[model samples]
Target: MYEVIATPFLEDFLVMRPGKSGGFKIPFHRYQELRDTAGDRPCPEWLAAATRKAWGVELSGRSADAVLVREPSSYGYARASYELNLGCNYDCPFCYLGKKEFEGLDWEGRETLLGVMRDAGVVWLQLTGGEPLIDPLFRETYGRAYELGMMLQISSNGSRLHDERNLNLLTQYRPYRITVSVYGATEETYDRTTRRRGTWRQFRRGLAAAREAGLPLRLNVVVVDDNAHELDQMKALADELEAEHFVYSNISPTIHGGPEALSSQSDEHLRARKPFTGCNAGITHFHADPFGLASICKVGRDEQIDLVAEGVEGLAQLPPIADKLMLRTGGCSGCALQDKCGTCRPLAKRYQEANAPLVSYCQHGRR
Candidate 1:
């Protein structure tokens, strides 16, 4: 019966019941009109009924109900990326996580955190890696969120998802969506990207098991220089599986601000990427590290606010802070190399070792 309200950046308002796993989206302009109507309005019966019908949950009136008010801005936080734990099995060359040190809130703490986020107006929660399936806290946290009706999204490498236990877990919780990163279409390409042989076979096996279990699955291909040739094959494979797919080519620096992984970005990768534009980090989206530290998003990892210490109430204090932190620097404000620049301030800062280099983030042809 908890009410979850989300105002996504560049999008509309999403009002949901996480305990029921159902919600609705409303345009910001219309939401504004609704917000002006005033005092603690009870959710419309139609919305509640539609939600319950969609997610197959009853509104028991156990959790706190939520209603959005006119905040300072139209965009409100709606989505959150929860890094259950940073430990991953695969060693992808282009991975941004680097070597993750395992740390996160305990099961009880995780449960509390979910409730806090729900209260704070987050409706869409993306459970991500290293590999969310491998996280020790995954099952408990996921099961609890399912019980509470959180619209969950999972990002995984498809390594452990084939296990019968994991497949059954997916069937039980029924996440709204599951995104698996397809490293390559062939074993050789997979090995080249992951540096792990025979993982392609394991990935296929897991993907089949998940599909057999009827899990809602989506595919994402990491378009790296090494796998650039296999893009067609990857898309064909996704088509063969009848799964929705997308390609990721923007290779940002590692969390440690190192350039070693940047070598994976090729000229083709640079050409394929869309131009740097505005980000919805602090305004509409956020990321929580394994240690319960929250930030605007993954790119802004360095600028973090401890969620465990401040609680949901602390979430209110971040938008203004994030606005201040989004400034461009290192001669990027009006650079003469605009024609060659391939990244924005946050990325430029990371690639330049926090110095904000004057050149593009891509080192492939530039060097």
Candidate 2:
């Protein structure tokens, strides 16, 4: 097991620790020096000093192979999100995933998928799902990703954060951050929104345990009609836990192009998003579902590459797919407000397919 990871991050170089947030950026020359050092040699003095200063750990006498892992890649993607499985313990009416099927790759397949991600140059990885913490292979998958030197962020509903096994694992190999969703501040509202009794107690316990364990956390206030009245209280709850928070008011159609989730949108709370200025989804990052199918991003799933079959080489097809998906075709093509449109092409297509009201996605509808 290595204590630090030295890798290339797009155009820059970074030295990061598995469980720590933020890392030291080093010049090309310094990275070269570390790369040139033989793995069997003692840790470089400068690296030892820097590691101690950055993470309060001394690596003076350890071999380079034991104290550090150098990750070099030819691919371009630097960040990615993997859905361990599409299963959940709670059934939130507003879930974009729609059908929450509890099925995914087995342990062997998952290990192979993680390796493929590593080879594809994914340094910042997010492990998510309907609820990733509850995946049967969550521990194995998480531990493997950590050992592979990816800085991880977990997206969850916080229902399982209180589990003794989960807490122990997370504490030992900490994630950079855990983003938990807040549906409501009170038990009644929370349980009602998730359509599960006792979910409120479980969520509360999970948050408390994660906090006590000193894990980095961020809260996403999921505002919906069912819990819109508790918006302020939800924000206050985040403040009470002293976690960073974000408000998510806009709800979208389900991934399968169903308008069901749109019914839960809190109209008053829905805010206009900034104009789409473009993103580096396929060029710099991508998303992987449970079956190891890679797409440009979460929203644009029209064309996918099967990583399980094609391996890292399959990622080469993404940039072109992304270009095609981003064009404002269909109802958006040649629209006068194309430049000022807030929704991206792929997402807009979903709303159109679902027959979602124009107000939900189009500037024309707002008029």
Model 2 stretches with alpha carbons more than 4 Å out = none
Candidate 1 lDDT score at position 174: 71
In model 2, residue pairs whose N, Cα or C atoms come closer than 3 Å (at least 3 residues apart or on different chains), thus clashing, are none
TM-score, candidate 1, is 0.78
The lDDT values for all models are 0.70, 0.91
Q: What are the per-residue Cα lDDT tens digits for candidate 1 across 204-240? A: 9988888887777899988888889999999998898
RMSD, each candidate, Å? 5.6, 1.2
What TM-score against the true fold does each predicted structure earn? 0.78, 0.97
